[model samples]
Target: MTDPMILSGTSSNLDSLRSQLIAGSEKVQLQIIPQLAELGNQGLEVIQEFLWQRREQTPTPVDGKIYQLLYSCGVPEIKDFLQVNFPQGVVPLKSEQGIDYIPLVELLAISDFQAADRLTIQKMCELAGEEALKRKWLYFTEVENFPVTDLQTMNQLWFVYSEGKFGFSVQREIWLGLGKSFESLWTKINWKKGNTWTRYPNEFTWDLTAPRGHLPLSNQLRGVRVIASLFSHPAWDNKK
Candidate 1:
């Protein structure tokens, strides 16, 4: 059953809610997006209604917020709805590992980088298996837990989506260029400014225009230990 507080909106109420969502501040939008997720199918219906109504209009921040909510809602049906509606916008790529991924460009097109990031990691976890738990803890001690092919696949998706501006491969290149100096790599990736490591979500850039390697994925925000695990992973040595 749909949560009453979530989708209690009549046509009139939804119209008012939509207007408020479009005009709301970032904090307001964040607070509301999660509530919309709680509505399940009803929440999706509201977003789909808005998307179709604005089909002829240029995408806006509100659209991004809506898409973010959709991704966070984690509904396979909602993702399918997006795939069907924006077929051309969502490009599919096959990794050398024989894994396939849908680039989050369709989501990014509406300007929702956070959703894209979340979806990217979600897709990676879906493909990689038990390694996800290891990834969550930034624990790559067991080489088998972190497959190079999966890492490559994740990196490829980010590279394709951001037009080569962000990805593990991009970070690898910078790391190699700096002679594998972790300190230099950190500074270059904006993970560190001078001697201080930058904070997550806030200090990190949530947009495509961010510098190369700024979108550190695989939940590396826990601390330097996570980042170290990622950098030291055997995946980089896989020529494939």
Candidate 2:
């Protein structure tokens, strides 16, 4: 792990160090990305502060590499920071159900769809709050339901980031088109084949080139109940 102090230096110094760290081989990036994230909120703050300082220097390759590192870190605080600070970067969207939402596109700028997908799920869990973990699925109730706005926000994020290649709305469209058959829906999303669920995090494609409806990731392989919980959510209902 690079010293936290290194990241706390002047913006130029931090930029130089970030360049050196990221410019190293892929193996180095793998090592450093996790270490940076391991620093937790402090590390995320350092990155955020640096990015803000360097905001004037747009379209730099270094920024791309740094954003990739941030997305790969999968820290919810980083996602929150990006969402709050770069509101314009996140595209506003509305679901067919008339839910207004916004997608976080700052991470998508890194072009790592797999990382974006993972981070999106983490962000959803964050938005869903503690009950989501207690319930073991994002269950919606009449009172303390999963916020439709947040769901739509995440869906839009996935849609815009993947160029309409993935999102809940995308999946919902395919689901309805296929008569809401989970089996066919799984196949359409490349999550199943020949009666076996696709292996998690391995067989899954990590690039934008993955099949349509392939994201806004649901951990259906966790069990059919997980899929049931996801599909049965009121957010999927088309009626406003």
Off by over 4 Å in 2: 1-87, 93-104, 131-144, 220-229, 232-240
Ten consecutive residues with minimal summed lDDT in candidate 1?
136-145
- Judged by whole-model lDDT over C-alpha atoms, candidate 2 comes out at 0.59
Model 1 residue 148 CA deviation in Å: 3.7
Give the Å error, residue 141, model 2: 6.0
After superposition on all CA atoms, what RMSD does each candidate show versus the true structure? Answer: 11.3, 11.6
Residues 1-240 of candidate 1 have per-residue lDDT tens digits of 887765545444656555655677755754555455555566567666666575556443445456545655667887787667755332333354455454455555554667777776666555555666445433334323556766765665455445456777788788889997878887887778997777666777888667788774544532456556666777778733
Clash numbers, per candidate? 0, 0
Screening candidate 2 with a backbone cut-off below 3 angstroms (N, C-alpha, C), the clashing residue pairs are none
Over 4 Å off, model 1: 1-111, 123-135, 142-144, 218-229, 232-240
For TM-score, the strongest prediction is 2
Q: How accurate is candidate 1 locally (lDDT)?
A: 0.60
Cα lDDT tens digits for candidate 2, 1-240: 977776666445545545655466644643454455456665555555655766665323334444555655677877776667654453444333443233346557656677676666555555566665455444434214456665656665666455456777787788879997878888988888879988878888877667888776656323555555555666756422
